[model samples]
Target: MQPLDAMSVFEKVSVADIPARSARRSKTTPLREAISALLPEEAFYVPYFDQETGEGFKPSTVAQVVGRMSKDSADYRYSVRSEASKNGCYIICNPKPSNG
Candidate 1:
């Protein structure tokens, strides 16, 4: 897995299976149902703006890329984006800065 500054996972999730377990949601739980979770808090926001115009993106108008480590030993997706969100993929990302 690649080194990432942070990780993120869906705000909501479930773990019921087979015979069916009590459908309960616990905020304090450490996301056990998920085989692994990505905590995207580490992603940096790279604000893209027109060079000539100082004006920049709106609340939801942002795009970006991120390199995050895999939460589990198995293969997994590195990042996610939110559509429908005016924030365009609700979350914007950027790479961590390198030491000079």
Candidate 2:
């Protein structure tokens, strides 16, 4: 598939382009199948990847690719789409920030 560089950062990522396994609807799947609906409702901490580790913050394109390229599986990787209440507050990746 081609890269989605044409999409802007503020664009709403569509599900049609994203694969079913990679695209998860919180309220659709079975009760036992809802990982996002687990014990805590902290979707903010949706956990794209561990920040402490050296892993980089994945771009929306990569996430879309993941969504369009795979099925939900034991090893299926995914990115919890940002639910930022404020628009234009996209997550920063490089040179981590601190609370101080």
Best TM-score among the predictions, by candidate number: 2
State, as a TM-score between 0 and 1, how close model 1 is to the true structure: 0.18
Q: Write the per-residue lDDT of candidate 2 for residues 1-100, one digit (tens) a residue.
A: 6579975578678889876686665422332233323332222222333367633333453344435432342333333446445221122122223336
Q: After superposition, how far is residue 26 of candidate 1 from its true place, in Å?
A: 45
lDDT of 1 at 71: 34
Q: What is the TM-score of each candidate against the true structure?
A: 0.18, 0.19
Worst lDDT 10-window in candidate 1: 59-68
Best by lDDT: 2
